[model samples]
Target: MKLAAPIALALSLAASGPRDAETRAWWATTATLSNDAMEGRDTGSPGYDRAARVVAARFAAAGLTPLGAAGGWFQTVPMAERAVTAADLRVGASPLAFLHDYTVNPVGLPARLDAPLAYRGYCGAAALGDVRGRLVICHATRKPGLPGDADRAAALRAGGAAGMIAIADPGFTVEPPRWPFAYARSVRLATQPAPAGGLPQLTLNADALGALIAGSGQDAARLIADGSAGRPLPAFDPPARLTARFAFAERSLASPNILALLPGTDPALADQAIVLTAHLDGYGRGEPVNGDGLYNGTLDDAAYVALLIRLAERRAGRGFRRPVIFAAVTGEEKGLLGSAWLVAHPPVPLGRIAADINLDQLRPIFPLTLLTVHALDDTTLGDDARAVAAAMGVQVQNDPEPERGLLRRSDHWNFLKAGVPAVNFVFGYRPGTQSERIYRQWYRTGYHKPQDDLAQRIDWKAAADFNRFFFALVARVADQDRRPAWKPGSTLAPK
Candidate 1:
């Protein structure tokens, strides 16, 4: 739904008694958590453990009961850390550096792989003719009828390819460094572990792709021009065998998912719960940009964690029919590890979770006039969110960029997969507006960078408005007699 009109920018600074106090408390908490001392609050790090203690303390002060294991505020999630110590891809005599020229996703790679290369133009079902036992080199295609990355990967694996190397489409615009961010070191669930010798996958930047074409009897310029013009290029075997090797170690760690409970007032409904969640982890350290190494993650997540704390504070001594669970999960940046663990091994029975309202890296840098609710139409939680947002004078809208598939990108996705209705909130903007400009700019510059620290600008009133709306949304869901459910025909709805 479209907002009736734009909210005046002046309302951004208009502050009153208790609201002003809430805003101040929110900022104060954000500053402390986003401080440099936190070391970006990376999952499985000492800094993250400290952040967990802080969350536990806050939850206690808010009069919430610890619902984690051992009656403590920490749910231990088993995770395995994998970092690429050395990775090299050689085409004939030309060798490519790991991060500078190409990078492999550590999640599905083996310790070493040596195979002949075959180019499957789009990795489409028809194009993947006989890639058995070869390293299939595929290009990312934005074609209308072609399959997506996941589909391509599945097809390649089914065709018995040893592995796949995905090269970016030459037509796509590459910002400055050609490839913006470095490959991430990942942490995944120990229970659902990354396949050690699975079909290995690697990605290459379009700009540095000349390395693959060297000595392969392939004209780099012609191939690039053909791909850029969206013309079909014949899939052929480049005259080179690939010897790719990666050195990495698997380390087990316990990441914390802070869980606290606010018991329901009504005895009957108190058995069920409405889960409120926000991830607390950020990229620990990677290739430095502009000489800074730490990713402070203030805007990305520390803000939302603080918002959860403040909402719990506001709900202190309040009454609701169903219990409320505040879950500050870790390893979200790594791939929703903590939330996956939560669903598999919950503080309460999985059947007892009525719904999930997850807060991730939601930007509040502009006026709080519109909200994009992911999975808004899939379940009744969407109705609850719309009603709450409308009551707060904010228009609720569906995901504008469905191609991004944002609903499955965050922690709530795991809960949804477990049959609990879920919704994720994001600041919305029009197609052509200043809000859109600001949103894109923030993502380009600070989304996961060290620049996301408290030094960056924010709309205080917008943050306060969203916090109030979210708190009310939680109360509304918690107080409802019946549990929220997925709408009819939604894939998320159980049979």
Candidate 2:
């Protein structure tokens, strides 16, 4: 399964040109960390430990000082893991394949579940019928007037349903639901309390809708079409029963965050450190898709982390006016656990941390013309980002899809919540353009699936341009005389 050599060589050859050195170097690091041998760098797994070691070695070679726990290169984070060892689900006599036809949420599950099926369109408060002790099936919709996941779940739980099975809405074309989940697992910090008495949840593949309602006197295709078109849906009890048996596995483990520092040369500004963060975790080994089970999160965050290492190399032991801390965190896919831990128990005092420049959700597949800047107006950091992007012929905009909640989805939110100015980015595309098509394709196929490996297409020039912009932005934030401050009248700003 060691495929790093061939992949790295191919990437280097593809990046050969005027900017070959930087492109090849960054892609090489990415290939090394995301290769099959790294096992997708799952948090608390041995693969992640190996990746952390490589990052620490790279930091050492770049002449950065280790700033982890006990003067070492690792910050140990304790965590609890829960997984579905085995699952069998059936709608009457038709059995549903786990991970392919459906996947369960891995918080906790009872050993056995046998309940009648109840279909309530959108599962809104008014639409839910007498679902007491029934297995409710809801249409997962994101329409403005529809009940979202939280509202639907609360309504179902209050209706005394034994469990919920939400049919994935096909109409969410912006980010279409992809079938065949990698796996079902959940992780949380050991100190956090485990969920109590929460209703078990499952997501049914929209494509497999027919199997669930075959004998229920309803047409699956019509129901899906009506749901997608926002038409009213009929509520009924499918003449069937849902029977499931689950085997649960639980364990305790610890993962480490790789921390390094490039100390400032000026005594006055040295104490105020600018923290740069990117998560170092991926989906790891999961249910096989296209016969490939490994979910190498190449573009999701590994590329940005490699960008961090490249930046350090470009520094060549030189220091900015203010010190910079490079943090490759863990457990982001599970939750924002690593960054939360760092914020709560920081290596340096929270007051001394001037700002956070997060690197995640940057996809350089298309030309780097537009960028979606998260937290674009909350702090002065946005001002600095706009200046840097404009100088490179790039236009920045606030998140175009606010409903996705990109602001709170990444590690930067932890720092921002703690009153530290922070920002993250996404590759943007204009409507009705090739860039939009490509961006949408990636979200549907590569966002969290096994297809996100090095085998995917990459725009070398675009990647290099983003790297330069990132380097310039970091230097601008670190060398500036004034600290990044929250803008006036901002909702997130401290009172």
Candidate 3:
């Protein structure tokens, strides 16, 4: 039986039924937790620990079962953290100063470096600077073995480069750098870095580098390959002549793996539950090392995660027709660690899971017009998504920037790795279509700066509407009578 939801369900949720005090509480919780001192929840910090406790408490209050690997809410996943310090990044003796001569990502934003930049190209592309026997820098944007990256790196190493330096791009920054300013504060958004790897690396202070990049374009690139000239190395040792004084360290760190469940009312459908997720960790504590601090992590996933917790509260009273596992995962920033752990050692049998809905973000900007059911092109899940969105009165679009790599970026990727069918919700990929120039403004100004704080500009009405639609869609999927199936030879598990 097909049930048609109110086409205006997006607008009139207030009049639809019981007042959603739970959703409101969830929002309050997110805002409060994110707003607390200790730099807005740096993972592994005291603030993060407190944040975890609060979430666990919230989950418990909402009546979620303890499905953590250890049977409690906290599943401590130990991470081996390393920061690359020393070696001011040289290429055969030509001195490359941090951000001035060759601005590398190093650790990207967390575990920043003050020395020994690894300069990894991660498969050499132009958007990223060139490297040959020189230290290379890159973000997590590129694919792992994109034809020539490895070849070039190998060639560079063979050419006598000392090491590689790479920093994963802090994915989707809302704007550029700024000190803590009131103008930037108040707005709250969220997302997680696209899933990425294990590499010896470092991070750069974007503020310092942004200035350098703005001044000279090509000259900035040359200075980073400092030692490549074979002996006449630039003298930067003296802090005054020290065009770059980089510092970093190599150490270990851990990440988070969030889990939530909505128990099914139906016996069979309940047995086959759904797994949803988003990463909760950022680039890990400061540069010249592997990463930085104050990752405030809104879209890096605070907001996405907030949504799951909120949904759990809603589902708690109503109860799931099928068990819903809203896993607020950690370590997705570090090789899908949390999701991998769950798939490997799930609270329930992995096969019992019917499907997964991994949410990264619809877009930082709310009131988004289109919905991108990313990577569901060949699956039945894709059809379900389209139908669900159409029913909600919104247009559904395919990922326009598939080349930017949305498919392998979110936590849902792990479910896919484990042979579970999954679909990710993507919004605002194309700069032009979203809101006539909104995307462009974000890329230039708010991409990753301290400026990406809460503000009046966000489409709260749109975001709220989308969330309502998402709530209904998931409900429809969970309650379907027929088992969702993939077409023959689809990249998903064999039917």
User: Per-residue lDDT of 237-280 in model 3, one digit per residue for the tens?
Assistant: 11111123445454445545656677778886766887777665
User: How far is 448's C-alpha from truth in model 3 (Å)?
Assistant: 3.9
User: What are the per-residue Cα lDDT tens digits for candidate 1 across 44-71?
Assistant: 9998888889999999999999999998
lDDT comparing candidate 3 with the true structure = 0.53
- The sequence of per-residue lDDT tens digits that candidate 2 reaches over residues 1-495 is 525474655475456532578788888888888887788999988999999999999999999999999999899989998899999999898899998899888775787889988999889989997999998888897888989999998998899989889988878887778888887888889999988868889999988888877788899989998887778999999888889999989999999989999999889987789999999998889887778888989887788889999999999679999999999999899888899988988889999999999999888889999988888899989999899999999999999888777899999999999999999989888999999999999988898988898878888888988888899999999999888999998888766
Task: Please name the candidate that would achieve the greatest TM-score relative to the true structure.
Answer: 2
Compute each candidate's TM-score over C-alphas: 0.87, 0.97, 0.69
Give candidate 1's whole-model lDDT. Answer: 0.79
| Ranking of predictions according to lDDT | 2, 1, 3
Error of 1 at 428 (Å): 1.4
Q: What is the lDDT of residue 465 in candidate 3?
A: 63
Give model 2 RMSD, 1 decimal: 1.6
